[model samples]
Target: MLRSTGKHSFTKSTVIFSLVCLLGIALTVDVFWATRSSSSSSVYSSIASNWPREESHVVVLPKAANDTDSEETVDDKANRVPQRLLSATFADIPAPELEWEQMPSAPVPRLDGSAVQIKDLLYVFSGYGTLDYVHSHVDIYNFTDNTWSGRLEAPKDMANSHLGVATDGRYVYVVAGQSGPQCRTPPTSNTFVLDTETEKWERFAPLPAPRYAPATQIWKGRLHVMGGSKENRHTPGTDHWSIAVKDGKAIEKEWRNETPVPRGGPHRACVAVGDELYVIGGQEGDFMPKPGSPNYKCSRRNEVVYGDVYMLDSEMKWTVLAPMPKPNSHIECSWFLWNNSIIIMGGTTEKHPVNKRMILVGEVFRFQLDTKQWSVIGRLPYRVKTTLAAFWDGWMYFTSGQRDRGPDNPQPKKVVREMWRTKLKL
Candidate 1:
């Protein structure tokens, strides 16, 4: 069964209540100090008490005759001096319209596949099938022809979901992923590279350790792979490594293993901007008490959603940035680079009644590198999970995934074959 990585069982109400209590105590102390001090005492004393008090050094300024003779009008009391308005001709121009355009569907309907764009074609790799079939089929879609075609099947050894696929504009690289049909399977280190020009596949050096659902990116001339499932789906591993590449081949140098992350999780979306790589939100194990444990009342070992974001630069330095505004986890969402800003669109999370269904949202978020802030930009046309997003020229394309809504039933629907494109407002 498909499960969401976004569910959390522990309550944060206790922590919130403690913070409120602290604020209340701070307010009470401020009030006591203000009333007790002479310099800060209340100024609203009765007129009778102030009148003719010989011991007090009080001087009242006389009010203007116009002010005392008539009460101020409501407009006069509320008005402020007007400031000069700045004018610009651009304000007359209408805002750009954003809409989705349907494109040619894939040859076969699949979910959780890896989509990579090279020039005018989009190559989709192996994915999980609607009826529990794991695929090795490779499909290619050409934008110029508005048609779909079949490519050679991915190598038998490298066929699976959770695979890390990336391209260097010439060659495509496939990395580790789960090798079975089950949600929780033994992750493999089988790796390969396909020559886009020759239409042939060749084996490449495997990962240092097994990983599934890892985030992969080709920055500069190297392939950087980080964070994923190891022994089991819940067991997130922290290992990160990069393989040096030159002239469409893995360099002879050994794969460099970097410092491990503080915490690791599966299906985290990562993207590369210039020399830096960003590891965005994903799922991690909640280290709470078990059901039968001593502190079991507060414990639910559910999967925890994360807004934890970390960045790694060229010098091999890692820095944690301001997190996403909300928890982002579970579904394999796409992270895109457009006009120097990062855009994350469409992913899923689980809502509770404990075993009912998944909650999917089409929300969009943008991360600004200069200010280290994230803002909600907009949303997708529909709710999607495990969808793929690509950018070409000025248009953004999103394709092929399950459109889950409300509750999941025994007989699930087929995977979507629709592809949607939009001209992004940069």
Candidate 2:
């Protein structure tokens, strides 16, 4: 009788365990089916919400002037003047189709430095400064965080000003600039490569010639250096050189000399957009008095400055474009390919004195590459010179430059620890 009772209990326990397992399986099936049924619809809703949807498109029409003024005012007569009319062609557009915002300032003041964007961060390096009384420091600003941070200093005794910086998506190539004991000395052809991922600096092949104020741009997987000073402070060279990379190292190629710049001058700025490189205005060679000439003792003729613009194609051919309305030198300007136009801003005009007067130009201009025409966009809010400018995320950024004082005070000044951004609109 006891053995019979034990067998009966064991059979009942087995039946209960089997029932529990079956219930779990049924619940899992119900959950899986429910999830599978909703997955496609959920995905579709997410994509639809994110898709760009056009709102009302309104057409803008110009408004006519009020008829209250029967006769034109004196200002109207002034506008009618031939010279004034020509100047009116460059009139300031009251509103920029673009928007602007202020960003965090650099850790320190800088001018004549190099700025290159890697991903979302703008890395600023080796500018002339008064920190520790003239320094070579590297600082970086992140667009995502809108903050500034210091990075590795330029590699091994690398002090530079107005150097050319270019990048190939992974590594930043620092070309020649003014370095060494004298601030005006041409930079050693020494090339420095900064790896963005590792935050490391490596020295590469030296440039063919000691160059300063040279413009650097990357094209067809090679870095191009063009139009800079060669040793002499006053002399500018049109020689162009390129460097090819292999397996994360820079291999200096033969210096491929191109057509010398037609209007050869110093401090000319260049930028690469699409397949073309545009070279802008700079100061010409200094004018030395001729021997036995009158006014040799008292008068020194200034070198002719250029406001002319030129474009270099992939074939090494150059074509001149519309000239800048005002000739400028020692100006910190930036170039960007925006909405089918090449926009330029900042830089000091020849009419403004760099030492005594700080002409902070807020005026923005755009060059329609297709039409060879220039039009004013808007003015910058602040006055700055010798600052570094760069573009990222549809905004133009200006960082660290010199401020001009009135003629009474001629001492060199600093405009560090400030940053500004202007957004481009279509």
Scored by TM-score, the top model is 1
Off by over 4 Å in 2: 1-100, 180-182, 246-248, 251-253, 286-303, 331-333, 352-360, 406-413
The stretch of ten residues in a row with the least summed lDDT in candidate 2 is 83-92
lDDT of 1 by residue, 1-426 (tens): 123322221235666788999999999999887666533233323433464532312233333333332565764344322221221110111122358889887766777777778888888888877535768878887777667865778777885788888888879888888765645345788888998998899988888888877878888788888787774555778888888886568885667887676568776777777778788888775223234544222233467667788988888888999987556664454766776688777665433322324445466778887787987776666666678777777778777776654333311244777887888775
The clash numbers for all candidates, in the given order, read 0, 8
Whole-model lDDT per candidate: 0.68, 0.64
Error of 1 at 201 (Å): 0.6
Q: Give the TM-score of candidate 2.
A: 0.67
Candidate 1 clash pair list: none
Q: Which candidate is the best by lDDT?
A: 1
